[model samples]
Target: MKSTDIFLEILGCPSEEMHEPVNAGYICPYTSDRCSKRGHGTNDPFPVCSIWKYTGARENRRKDRPVIVCPKRFYTADIVGDILEHVWVGPYERNKINAVREIKMGKIGNVDMVVCDTSNLPALDNFVSVELQAIDITGTVSDVYTSHLSQTDLIRSPKYNFNTANVHKRYLTQLIKKGYFHSTWRKKIVAVIQDVLFESIRERVRFAATNPKDENTSIVFMSYTLDPTETDEEGYYRLKLKEVVGTEHSVLMNAVVYETPPSKDLFVAAIKRQL
Candidate 1:
């Protein structure tokens, strides 16, 4: 099936264009275009406005510059969630897809996305944690620096070094803190990364999956490529999951228990000085 079909099935197409007459005394926040109505309304949750389109088009016209503002930026998370639901969960699993954007787990800080079963009361069981990273990994150092020093700098910067130890550390930290490694329920962590970035860290991912300190947890890596040539009817770039790799111990890693530290606040003080 065409990639567009998958997107359409999961997200549905954008709502048809609204042709409602503008209310009197209405002004466009973006372009200052006067409207016949006081407010604007559209059936589509994500309505395409002329301002965004024009800006994106203008940015794309610059051959030497990076196109930072595009439709893919907005729908990437939704697309990933849909792909996970269809490809990983499938119809047989009695699971509900939940996309938690920035949930905090102890010291691990904010996690990207998490999918879990809704039928189960305790949402931690039978879940998958996904981290999505989308960036142009092919740009030369100079090109990247010119576009935005902050964009790809994390991958090579001395402090962040995103591709090397940081990726594994962050992923493992999230898995451990989320109880994915310690829970007695089925749990998996998937990292959805761009193809170029995935290649740079494929070795690390393999090593981590192969030699997980905690034998009970498994990590899966899925790489996606955006086809510059292929776009949907809406002119949005098409994305394809190029590859998926998981460790041989994936099955064995299920339902293993890992101990967690005691909460200091929950326990009584060791000594009472002067009650």
Candidate 2:
């Protein structure tokens, strides 16, 4: 099936019902932590499975407000590792893959996750740095709309869309810096993002693919969503990851050199105050 059709089908389905436990023997794919029956927003110490929580509550409500929770936490590194093992890399070789979470690289900061082929250890080329970015889907509607208008009217706009601008600054920029640091190693970086930032992400990818640059970087974009039809024993939605854009060498190379303004301190501080 077409990627667009899959995206629409997943989005149209109710988030809570997307993944339902077929039997009592199914296991939670996210983590090994024991699953609890407590609903979200309670003070219960036991952690509930993410699939059991309501991911589309904002969509169902009349307020149109953004969900404050981070979606990345729901789809943790282990889950990402499983997806990469079974889907991107063949399951036969999945045993060779090792996933490490929150590993700090010198100067580049703590990356969300890193996947490496254990058989090829000490070879940086075998390592893939993964970054997870989940933006507030409903919160930046006005900004996204404005960005679309500017694009259609041929107006000069900012380098990144307001909604995902921070993601570019915080995550993608760090990947570029790491690429320069490990230029000889030729490590690959993958950025996994939610589908809500699709248009903004495509714009960034198009700009990068068309532009010429000197950095020999390899980056990939993986878009993920909850599977509408299946779930685990914990009744959490299954995740589906797809390569949406920027898997080409030309795109990755140019994308790494895209100019990023050093306004993170100010921007982050402002956002924190608002929160």
Error of 2 at 202 (Å): 1.6
lDDT of 2 by residue, 1-275 (tens): 11121112111122222222323222333433333333234333212122111233334622221221244344532444544643243232567877787898876587777877676557634566777766532222223223322333323322211346666556555655654554446555666665545455566644443111123445556666545467545554455554444444444446546545569999999999999
- Model 2: how far residue 137 lies from native, Å: 7.6
Candidate 1 ranges beyond 4 A from true positions: 1-95, 121-124, 135-185, 203-217, 248-275
Candidate 1, residues 68-148, lDDT tens digits: the string is: 111223344344454454335434343455555656655656556666656656644445666654332121223222222
Index of the highest-TM-score prediction: 2
lDDT of 1 at 112: 65
Model 2 quality (TM-score): 0.50
What local lDDT score does residue 254 receive in model 2, on the 0 to 100 scale?
69
Whole-model lDDT per candidate: 0.40, 0.45
lDDT of 1: 0.40
